[model samples]
Target chain A: MLTYANPNRFMQLARRLTRPVWGLSLACLIIGLYMAFSAPADYQQGMTVRIMFIHVPAAWMSLFVYTFLTVSSIFGLVFRHPLGHVAAKSAALIGAGFTLITLITGALWGKPMWGTWWVWDARLTSVLVLFFIYLGYLFIWKAIEDPLQAGRVSSVLAIVGFVNVPIVKFSVDWWNTLHQPASVSRFDAPALHSDYLWPLLVMALGFQLLFFALWLLRMQTEIFKQKLRVRRLGLVETSNGTAS
Target chain B: MEHVFYIGLSYGVTGVILCLLTANTLSAFFSFRKQIDDEFKPEDSANSP
Candidate 1:
């Protein structure tokens, strides 16, 4: 783990892993989409059941990515790992994208099934708050000029905002809501039929792999940006020294 | 078949968003790499001379 803390070593690893990760993600998404479309429609929801293939996976990823950001923020704070900050920063946009997809798809699914486009239900409200928290975390990084300070403030906010995750997860059970409770995560067994379950799981995996591939690319970009800043600063110093 | 619109729209929107995000990240990466390479080439030439 410490060995990877070195940015150069990490970049080398990232470059080597990039092609394989991308290939795997592409393969998974193709298989997942094929399975998703092939699955028969639900007896109750009819064709709308198809929305679950995308909606459920997006919802899962929204939370998963936030949790990932929180963990990376913690590493940045505790270990002072630069890579951690880069990772957390890169993940925020992707996580926000997932959250947006979740909310929009949920609305689409809800309009057809629940006879409404939006609801102020506990589960829905909490997820919206989670989305705002992602925005706020990203805002802190943008507003602060100093990288260290920005990272520290953002890390603190991320840690604090993590309380909302569980609230979003358990809101359906803890309170009355239009949203359905956990179907696939329960210890007993997934409530879904195998036909639906398999595709959902595959899509979830594909989304996760896609997230990782994007995250790595973003992190690599950030590392290069940092290097560029340093080189430019060196050039400035060299000119200043020569002038003096 | 009526519900097909909602399902199609949902997947379409998600697909668009993911594609945009992927494009933005990759473009930023390539641009930064180019900037860093350009910065280094000048320095290397100056140092050799």
Candidate 2:
């Protein structure tokens, strides 16, 4: 995993894979969207049920990306892998974007389906906390001028905030909800019908692939920016030394 | 289900956002690379001296 940190090697691999990724994303999304639309609406939930296809996948992605970001941050801090910080920062920001979409789409869905734009339920509250964690991670990156120190500080926040992830997952399980409980879990079989289940899965897969492609591209950009930052700082220090 | 509106909104929003993110990432990558390359040029090579 750490071996991918070599920027030249990473770029070599990234350039080779970039075209295929875009092609795959295009195919997956086209097919997935068709299936998502084709699925019959719930008799009880009615047309608003259509929003579940989008909302559920977005909710799943928000959690998955945040977990990926946090684990990478730990790997960067504990193992001192150079690429860890880049992966973590890029993923955090992207994850935050996904989380925002989740909340927005959820609210939209909730407005029609649940009769409210917001709720104080455990599941909603925990997800709200997850959003804040993402914000805190972004603030750390923006506030610190020194990238290394910023990385160091945010890694701590990321690792600590991970405790909330499980809390989010369990909130729906532990508490009763007007919102439906988990459909799929590793321990228990999914509750959704095969008709509705398949499209949701495909859309989820498409979203994950898109997430990876975006994360890789952004990580590459951040790495280049770091190189530029070091070069600029070195120039400033040397100019001062010569003048003095 | 409202056939046109929901599907239109979902796909419309997704497409526009993806396009924006892709363009934004590419611009940042190429521009940052150019900045770093210029900083390391021989004429302004502070570390070389």
The segments of candidate 1 whose C-alpha lies over 4 angstroms from its true place after superposition are A1-5, B44-49
TM-score of each: 0.95, 0.86
Q: How does model 2 score on DockQ?
A: 0.35
Whole-model lDDT values for every prediction: 0.91, 0.79
lDDT of 2: 0.79
Residue-level lDDT tens digits of model 2 in A99-195: 7777777776677666788898988888989999999999999999888899999999999999989988888879997667788655667888887
Q: What is the lDDT of residue A151 in candidate 1?
A: 86
- Model 1 interface RMSD over true interface Cα atoms: 0.7
For candidate 2 chain A, the 10 contiguous residues with the lowest summed lDDT are A1-10
Number of the top-ranking candidate, with DockQ as the measure? 1
- Mind giving the per-residue lDDT tens digits that candidate 1 earns over A120-226? 99999999999999999989988998777898899999999999999999999999878989899999978999999998988898899899999889989988888
Alpha carbon lDDT of residue A53, candidate 2? 74
